[model samples]
Target: MDDGSGIAPPHIEGYEILEELGQGGMAEVYLAEQKGFGRTVALKVVRLSKYTQVDQKELCLRFEREAKIVGKFHHPNIVTVYDVGTMGNFLYMSMELLKGGELTTKIKSGRVSALEACNIVRSMCEALSAVHAKKLIHRDIKPHNILFRDDATPVLTDFGIARSVMNSGDATGLEDIPDLTEVSMIIGSKRYMSPEQSIAAPLDYRSDIFSLGVVFQEMLTGERPVNFHDPASVSNPSNNTVAWPQEALIFKPLVTKMVEMNKENRYQSIDDVIEAMDTLDNKFVNESAPLRISRIYLFIPLLFLISVAIWILSPFTTNYELTALDPNNRLIDKSSLSIYLVEGLEKIRSFKSLPVGEHKIALKVSGYRTKVIAIDFPLERNTTINLTPVSSPSVEEFYTFQDLLEKGPANSASAKEFTERYGGSVLSDLVDIWSGENAVLLNELSVAAKLNDPSAQLALSELYDRGWYVPKNSDLAQNLSKAAAEQGYAFAQFQYALILMSQMKYTKDEEEFIRLLEQAAEQDFFLAELLLGMIYANREYRSYDPEQAHRYLRRAANKGDRVALYELAQMIEEENPEEAKIYRERAIRLGFKVNQDF
Candidate 1:
């Protein structure tokens, strides 16, 4: 139980408590060491003073509900829950530890740039979109609940008060809790709550949107709009106005719609908000005078010099104009050929203005193998290149799908056609990662996995690991992950290592876990590097090695992981306090958090 001073870290089986991270009214978060895995996790324990039967039952239900809610999310912007269980009066859940701290700090500091605010809102919108897709409402969408990862990615967390919008068969398992409706009503933070939320009215996903809009404004101007605080203010339809700062006016239209007095007047879905925000963000980046001016002076001179040099060299140099013909003797589109100047195979649009000697260039079209052509350039009228197309039609289709996906979100018609054409094939699942439709991806992967595709297996492994739309099955996840790992897929290796680390206790199993992580790290997988760093840095472990820890942690830090930078500082504090302080400060500027004493 938390006293005025602090709460004692609870003794949880299978985890060694390192230190207390923080505490709220209902829970205390502790930094704990997962035994055997040598992994660090933020362990949240339900903290109650003078616990009664009613209070105990309520807290436990809420705690379990949070785990279930967060567990179902397999999104990049949502926190990952590793494990959950009960120990006497304490109900503890282990989750990914985020060192970048809360969005609250940035908002409170009043130093958030307009771009930063936009990024935060965009990321949260995506997260909430995932929430709403599951027929759930976060209820709480304030800055306090939004935490950041080392990469400065905003992560939606703390789902203790989150409730599903649907009344029956909610996936969060809230139906079992008898008083959940009463507990959820009128429960969110007042300063960020919607008028309907404040009045204990039935809430929907729009309530969360209203709260997020308040958060968005706070991030820009360091204060919530007045209309949200008092229910009476928002009750008046005409008073639904926000006084945005001059610099933040670009966002006013979106925010105004988000916090509209009438839910019907607001954006219908998070997807619509995302689409609008994406357009606004792109416009701001492209058209902002200050942003354009920052590079104009340098870019203009560089571009002009290059253009002049090209024009001056045009006459003397031989122009090796090349045309490619497909297997069917049809002229291949120039855009389709990814031309490269040979020797080093450096990418170029065309072999123009080259020396009149033996010249070689490589052509790589989507459905063809990379073909290198040797040309005696001085006297040739025009070079004709013949390209061989791949035998499989699926390979060609896959490339087309890949190209469409790379350009942008594929159109619904194209996506639907691709799925219908290649429904049960490995190629479709391999390319569907960006489809943003989890249900379809799951079904497609389930079929493709049976065909023994490594990529499909890995993808399915992750889906099962998160239990996003299925029952949580660690055994199945481990098996699938292991199969993909054995095929030498780096991401699969990392994931398999994680599953093994969580379950393995034997020395041989620990060695295998480390081996898998090391394999993935060797492939420059930054997640593996981050995990290896943490594992080697754990002082509680017998295998703790500071040198190895620093090496791996530095690798991850170099990859723009702010959490790794913070951890590096913490690891070296005793040996090199001054350098440690520098690393910590660098992490702080990158939006990571350091303890007050540090």
Candidate 2:
């Protein structure tokens, strides 16, 4: 059956292709009827010929592993993967098909109502929470990947680039899946990428949360929260950027925390985000509830009597004023304080008056721990309580250190103070690495590597390979990387593989070199996968195998790699002009310059 794209759908057993639903970088989704089940499903098909091949075995294994990982997810908010199989050079996955349309369509229409946006985000949190529980990082969480059921319940789909977080104890089946890492071959849209994801850094559940925050903001304001011209500014977006309708004001604080550029500052867990959203939902409901005007006369009399009684007892009632103090007993800003009275479950103003009695209340301040204190009115009418600051340094301190560090080693003393304050922390370690002397840094890394720490071994490997703060030593780099690689580090394996190739030992130890590459590729290391494809496709390498070349190239091309696309197109130009034209067009669209009249 022809999918409207003019390409005939691969005939898979037990399913009849109806029409194409959509197509992404690697897969084309079609609406199909499942036999026996007598139900419609989305059949996502990835044609092997579409991407240039690198290694046939590795490509097939990666595809099957991805399917198995996603198929295990069984959440209502997550799209269901029913079955997966290969048919005639095509890998097809049967999944639940939703007709309500993509979240992108809803976002394009205009800003969604506050309630609807909250509900959608709540669903996403639940879905993502489940994925995180399984130790998987979605990597991609944008409106385009979010669909809805007929009832408008948001469902997350597309785990194409999602992978398990490192050091996962429960990520059983996901251990073997290859995750895309190279910046050039990074899959998914860049607009919604988290700050860390943009640089192809290690990711966790918080990465997905940042992307979700971007989508949530877009859904509310009809624009992304990020400043496209200065994406780094997303960490602290000003309230004035988007004119949030008065009704959506409740979402401002929650959304602000979601898109924090520093993952450490973002919501630590999906449950926390969900809880915050629930609070917003309750506040929104209470604020939006219409005032009833019935029984005006009776209500007016009752209100008058209460006002008269309160006025009579004005002298007797003690005015309760709260002052939140910092560690030094200095008063904090009133705007930073959120006071809640335990009695009557009321949220009171910071300086509001209260009745003369012992009252319990909770106080929350930005960058400080929440404190609950009980105070008796009339005895201590005005109270001051010291709020212990959180142990971690605030974002402002980080900025201060960054500015000082930029002044070079001359200002290293000032930067060292900042690092000392957060001693033994990750931030401090990073600062020490950057602000300290290169000789000291190299010595420290060497000591750690000597202790057989894989992380240190990997770091030393890169430093030695590039001659950073040390003389260039390819042999030492290879040995260090191989040490880390032997301990089952995927990135280290990739590095060692490249180092092996650079040493030109592949001519004598071709088997071992290819083994390293496959080991790394099997872990979904993008560069290793790309390298294998390139090596097999080129006659310069003894590993040249046409079938392997095509498989690896196809996988890389499907990942939006322009080089892969251009090369794959050239390889198949004579035999498969039609497919080659499609590949070439894709390359051109990606801004790959080609000579006219090929």
Candidate 3:
């Protein structure tokens, strides 16, 4: 639907439209050049279709109000609002035009790399943080509202739909209406709507987090978590099933929390989400190391004593017992026995009860050379047995694994130094790992995890469940995450719930996921709480009840999750507009921002 002339609505003020950028149900955005500045900008003009003079006046006022709200924000991540005016019957707002396309388009094209996606999200979080700090809630957040420049930096646009904390004088009257003919009962894009928003409840910043979670999922998986043909379908329980495609690369835990149905179970604030991302990054870099040393040191002596006791308890010369030992000449930990068995096997002779007269045992570990030991056991009495592993290579020759352990303090110090020198680069790198190459970065991760690195374990578990770089191994991921969770890693516990939810192949086990999510939420893993909220909000997942979701979401919103604020506002307002108005007021004070189309 284009003409070569590219002229739209004649001429608006002194500016001329060269081409139509796009059109929505309510308005048309144009690619235009300013008359005096010759600078190109996006010109948004209201459609006057089927409107009376009264409606026109109301619409004009709303459009002007949007400009006023957006123009006040001057952050780098926010799109610049240039001018606002009316040309005859057509009212318009002029704003900065980003050359890049919408985030949705980029995701659809499958060109958004994991790192790039994380970077975009980081910028968005920064912007949202700023908006929240200023006490504004973006009522609507969707891919179309985000403009990505050539550098891949995202500029949040469209403040027309933004709910502001600052008083707008009479303009508040227009926003105060219970329902406007132009106001679709559905407030946000169906695929990205928070539970409260889908129900026409009042909303705040938490609503934005819900939408961002959807956006993050789409960026990582190349598809939206929820797909619907119409806005009404968003609230349909039958359409709520979540399935990550086989081809998709997921950080399971992150996706799980992001898509939590409840606002409280999600990240309490953008900062929390950012912190989770940071933890994931550290996990990807080193999986097990210093922790490995600690585990070996703690259990080595115990394992050796147990093996000796088993040997002593044997009754006859017909019995034989075999045990493996590490390079340190200590018995291998029970947890790691499987790996030891797989790696070292010389021969399998007949097995007896125990206390064999004589036996030969061979042992091998990754870094050490093989060693064989000859043992003789007394048939009638307890005897002692000992075997020493040969040191095949010097510490420097085969020390990549050891180097990972050594690199811990170095990397930490380096990161600190880099951060001090280059500001956010070190943190940015960490975010990249958490959000990007988590699965494939296993060796590095194993070193960190073995060292009981909380951050590394969290990232590894997230990658495993999400199938980021490895096969989707929810069981293994859950096990690792459980270990980390037990260690008091909040990020790990939050992600653990996500893995549990995904593996809920049985019906009765749903409560287990809820319990884990609740635990994580208590630790301030806001995303887990938000998921709990969503679960309670929906009748299908509301076995625990909606009140629970509300309670948790309110907690997160209070912590400054913009998306939660919007959701809570919407929920309260549906039943009690006055109460909803108070929540909305709070959302404004908290500073939530979103694209506006009036």
Best by lDDT: 1
Per-residue CA lDDT of candidate 3, range 57-130, in tens?
A: 77777787677666555455788666888775567788878998888788767746554666577667767876
**Two-way TM-score contest, 2 vs 3, winner:** 2
lDDT for 540 in candidate 3 is: 73
Between candidates 1 and 2, the TM-score winner: 1
Regions of candidate 2 where Cα sits further than 4 Å from its true position:
1-6, 55-59, 180-185, 228-240, 291-598
TM-score for candidate 1, residues paired by index: 0.54
Error of 1 at 57 (Å): 1.1
Task: State model 1's lDDT.
Answer: 0.71
Query: Which candidate has the top score in TM-score?
Result: 1
- Please report how far candidate 3 places residue 62 from its true position, in Å: 2.0
Residue-pair clashes per candidate, as listed? Answer: 0, 15, 75
lDDT of 1 by residue, 1-598 (tens): 3342333567789899998888787778999987744668999987544477898878878777788778676565788788898875578999888999998888766658877788788878878987988888898888888998776768899888888784635655545654365734678788888878988888888888889988987877666666655557646655645456766778888987887877899898887888798677755653453454455547667766555345334542334467898767899987455554554333442233344457666666654534556676544657887865422123245345545554554565666667677654434544354455566556545643433345667767765665645676766777787766765666678778888887777878778888998988887777678788988988855557878988999997787666788888888899999998998888777656445211
Candidate 2 structure quality by residue, lDDT tens digits, 323-358: 888878898987456565654333443222344457
